[model samples]
Target chain A: MFTGLSAFPLTPFVDDAVDAAAYAGLIERLAASGVDSITALGSTGSYAYLSLEERSRVARLAVAHAGATPVHVGVGALRTSHVLENVRSAEAAGASGVLLAPMTYQPLTPDDVFQLFATVADATELPVIVYDNPGTTHFTFTTELYGRIAQLPGIASVKVPALPEGDAAASDRMAQIRAALPDHVTVGISGDASAAAGLTAGCDAWYSVIAGTLPEVALRIARAAQSGDRDAALQASAELQPLWNLFSTMGGSLRVTAAIAELLGLVAPRSLPLPILGLTAAQRAEVARVSDELGLGG
Target chain B: MFTGLSAFPLTPFVDDAVDAAAYAGLIERLAASGVDSITALGSTGSYAYLSLEERSRVARLAVAHAGATPVHVGVGALRTSHVLENVRSAEAAGASGVLLAPMTYQPLTPDDVFQLFATVADATELPVIVYDNPGTTHFTFTTELYGRIAQLPGIASVKVPALPEGDAAASDRMAQIRAALPDHVTVGISGDASAAAGLTAGCDAWYSVIAGTLPEVALRIARAAQSGDRDAALQASAELQPLWNLFSTMGGSLRVTAAIAELLGLVAPRSLPLPILGLTAAQRAEVARVSDELGLGG
Candidate 1:
């Protein structure tokens, strides 16, 4: 369930509320796509911007519309109690797994993060993926801390950030992380642009943002790498370099992904939560132009 | 209202609930301590770990019990709408000012942070304090960015983290920040250990975490500096070097302050929110010995 491309969809909004119909459509689309799993309420989903009720509803909606695909729900919150509540909500919503990031305001020590993971792992029956996206959560996990957390019960996966650029370096990085954890915990790669390199470097999964909206394209790269066609995987990713550039320069993937979604008519224009003004009109036009040139929009 | 000693009280918890009796007692104590102001929901108050309802209740309680001392509420949230809601709550609670940290989950751009403060400044009648606590928020503010935000309407104060060790270096740092803002916007200093140096270096306010627990001692330092008695202020701070050393070595001031509160019988033992284990018993006893030696328990 944790292997291959885990598509993370945006939880689109309308008039300051979760656009349930639009969100359900997204899940149904992901369910139709042959990705390994569907992860809802990821950073791409703007989980941090939502209320508890909204998060719970999003979790339930993801499960209900995902069809036969396993759904992993992001259950990160600033408080351990809130994270546990989110985990319970995910469990009740019938999620197959939970992604836990050490969401922080206070600068967290390694022990603080380990304790947070330990507490959640103790409370939940579901498999936990250590969500290590320092870009959003601002809590970096050391390899030693990763080893400590993976030793805890129910930590089934470790979703690491981008790998080093070259294949040898990326592989060396992956090997270092793998040596730190037990064999059962799969290592998944995030950072959409680095997916092909990471996949070719032997990461078990691509925990992806781009795959959520444009599944066929991400699937092309993932399948090529998984089937040992490294050139094809790299080629597929290289074709979408424009989109990756947008993600890097324009703050992060969330707003640009929202722009792409809006362009494709997959979600409402200006669908992101407030304070996150999705993208400038010119930026959206650039995204549309790049996305169209690459035949991303069907 | 933003000058002198602005005490940041801990919102102590017992059995994972906000101990209202203990919190109110803290506010009443600060109110009678001749401190310039009382700031509720600052990092010392554990604002990020609280729910909206709990935060609103704490805001109201601070206003209700602060007597004649002006009360400032930290009205920061991950979402803009939620931050506006907190600002509205503080205004309705009769708070004199609101502290706005660009509390982030998704790393914000300078534009995003500026827009956040602008939006909040527009929405509320209460004056805004630009909370620049990089240690907690993981968002560092540039002097240029400070100039930009201070230009926004209703931004009254800037709560900076810490200053350099030497008096001359701290004074230069203060001058650099002062040059970035308008004449009306006051600069307050946080970081309990740096309060004396910051105050002596011409910071308008000492946003003291220790002051929240031990107002008289903070007042002694703050008053000495404000009255141009720099030697007295430095001497007073030097006398409590043990307490300052504990804060430096023990994660931060919150745990040490909580330990001191527990030792002083100001709040219930083990009062911090879950996942933030206050301190080991040995650490707590160390705080006790230091506080007792400094005559901080009285």
Candidate 2:
């Protein structure tokens, strides 16, 4: 269930509230796009920006809208008690798994992180995905630490940062992570730009951002790589270079992706939570131009 | 109100709930101890681990128990909206000021941070202290960013990380910060170990952790520094070197401070939020020995 494309959709906001209908629509679209799973409240979903009630509602919404598609809910929070509460909410919402990231305020030591994972894994029956997105959570997971956590009960998979761009580097990175974990634990890649290299170099899953708002493009690349058509996967990913470039220049994927979602009318005009101004009109026009030139408009 | 030793107290928890009586007692202790100010919900207070209700309640408790001592509340959140809400709560609690840290999940840009401060500063009449503790927030603040933020109207102070150890380096660092910020915005120093040096080198305040628990000891140092007695200030800080060492070895200040509070019976045993196993029995023994030897007992 964890070994393929997992689309992470935006929890759009309108007037300081979660746009429930828009969120459900995005989930329903992903469910019909043949993606392997739908991950709600991932970093791209702005989970940290949400309240507990809002997170719970989004979890239920994802489960309700995603017909037959396994849903993994992000349950990362700063406190252990809150993380457990989130895990319970995910379980109550009938989620397939819970993604745990060591969200920190005080810089955490290795033992601090290991203890967090062990505590969560002990409290729930749901499969746990070790979320290792340092770009968002600011906590890096070491392979030794991964080995420690993966040995614990209920740790099913690891969502790692993107592998290196070079095939050898990517293959070596994947091998190191794979060697650190048990056979039952799968390794998935994040960082949308590195998805093709990661998948072609032997990653079991592509935990993608673009897949959330534009699943078909992400799936085209994921499917090619999974079928052992490395060249085809690279070609498909290369086609979206313009979009990737925008992600880099625009200070990360969230704003640029929000712009794309806005352009496609998937969500409201200014959907991002406050203080994260989505993008300037000029930037949005650039994103639109790139989206159009790449034939991404649906 | 932003000068001298501004003690940051731990928001003690008992049985998964905030121990209001214990928290009030800690504030009363600080109020009587001649500390310059009481900062509730700083990193040591576990603000990031708290819910909105708990945070709001803690803010009120600080203001109510502080007697005549000025109270500053840490009003930081992942989203700007939540931050604004916290600001309102702080103001409603009659706090003297609000300490703003760019607590992040998604790594923020300089512009994102600037906009956040601008929006928060514009929304409230309460003075905002720019909290630049990268160790906890993981967001490094450049001098340029500080300069930019200091230009905003309600920015009254900056609580910066420890200055360099050397006298010359400390003076140079403090000079650079003072150069960046306006004269109206005072420069305060965090990192208890570096307090004497920071104050002697020209910091206007010591945003201290140890002061919250052992105000007498911190006062000796702060009073000496404020009176221009550099040697006395250094000697006083050096006397507590054992406690500082324990802070370094025990992951960080929060656990060791929690142990001290427990040892003093200011709060119950196992008072920290879960997954933050306060300290091992052996570590507690070490803290007790150090506290006893330093004559830190009340």
Candidate 3:
């Protein structure tokens, strides 16, 4: 159904190679914690940075470790052919579905965006989740575009980032998109902080970053929101607000999540690509304070 | 001294593979028409869409066909390590220099931008041409960042897209960037339509698109502008304005240039990636009319 909390696990690296054992452990932990699904090779997973062979390896490892939980692999690339190749690899690796984002160096028109998704969908029997991440791709998909995309065979869901805090216009727009899209197309909210509001507004699921490392907390909030327990959901959301603030202030969650994962000994210490450094001592202290207050790490 | 008219050759495709013979012929035509240099795999060449091995093959073929003209290869990638790999391949391919743009899915800070270029520059002996194409890369380099990048060991030139039509502010900004950069760093202007104004404003070279297919005419305008013959340069530019208007109206030059090249039989018919199809019938007609008026093709 593509609903409930889907955890996006970080791809742990050791000496620039994918740390297979640590990665499998992370997936196992998420599954044990009751996440509905696992999305590997997401933005936090450094999908774009990994080589083709490495991505294929990660996809296979994630599927193997996920056990009963379905794993959705990101198959985005600048070229459609490369993306198709990734999709084939995911299928071979036994991935449950594929997440597609329109990534290009050029400014792609709406027609271009449709063509990319349509071509990909035509090539794969696996369910496709359309990812609308304008912040990274610099390409925005209108509700009109989404409606058209939903008509494509095998396109079963969409992952939309929550609007900025307190933008009523954006909230209204999300509602409009939900109403316009086919009832069969599940719409999930992304961005850790937006989960509370997005759920209250009737999004089908929360594609969570924090859930990757702290699945129990994320699942509590999602379950509360799903059952219409506003108070419980908001209370859990408030508990994680400190961590969310760090993610927002840090420009992205990848480095902060990686740092937190390392601090808690969830993964081995490894270097990220240049220009994306780990958290500083001050940031690490702040994370520790938040984690301790929330009893996140054992 | 990577100055004057640098033609960015299109990577011709046949049966979904790089058409090596047609590609060689395109490079030969550009060099024969007196281009100052040839930049293979530039935006016009669809560098982002090509595989690593294909890019290497194109780089080697370009250098071979360039004769005495310098060949510069695009080395932009999501990972710094990949860029370094490409830089090494370009050097091995005998490319004279490398063009680099900061390409990442995440928004990069100025410090991140500096580190990307610094690391690439440190790894190569080839002169680096800093490409500031905000349209494609979605990353803008401030003049301050350029100042820092210019101080790097191997950086020798900067390619700035010409300001939008009638944007005096952007022209002034280019001047500011030129003044801010080290004296040894040459500044060139891109966007075929902007050549006249960019040259009149003192940019050292015209990194051109049309020049790849219609090098004789592009070179005429550039040479006239270089010799301080503003009247001749503007007159030549006026002749190309109809074509320029098409480029502006259509949003980018890749499809337009591809259609024109095919119309003129400059290269064999080729396929672009889905979502980036060649110009439509109406667009092709406009291109043919403009090309005919400019005496670009038989």
Q: What does candidate 2's lDDT look like per residue over A53-95, in tens digits?
A: 8999999999999999999999998888889889999999999
lDDT of 3 at B43: 88
Which tens-of-lDDT digit does each residue in A145-196 have in candidate 3?
9999999989889999886566475578677888778888999899888788
> Compared to the true structure, candidate 3 yields what TM-score?
0.95
Off by over 4 Å in 3: A163-171, A278-282, B163-175
Score residue B75 of candidate 2 by CA lDDT: 94
Docking class of 2: medium
| Per-residue lDDT of candidate 3, residues B152-235 (tens digit) | 999999998776465476667777987788888999999888788788777888999888877887888999999999788878
Measured by TM-score, how close is model 2 to the native structure?
Answer: 0.96
Kindly indicate the candidate among 1 and 3 with the higher TM-score: 1
Off by over 4 Å in 2: none
State the C-alpha lDDT per candidate. 0.90, 0.92, 0.85
Give model 3's docking category: medium
* Model 1, residue A206: C-alpha shift (Å): 0.9
Q: Which ten residues in a row have the lowest lDDT in candidate 2 chain B?
A: B271-280
How far out, in Å, is residue B150 in model 3?
0.8
Worst 10 residues of 3 chain B by lDDT: B269-278
DockQ, per-model, please?
0.68, 0.66, 0.62
- Ranking the candidates on TM-score from highest down gives 1, 2, 3
| Candidate 1: regions farther than 4 A off | B165-168
Estimate the TM-score of every prediction.
0.96, 0.96, 0.95
Chain B TM-scores, listed for every candidate in order, come to 0.98, 0.99, 0.95
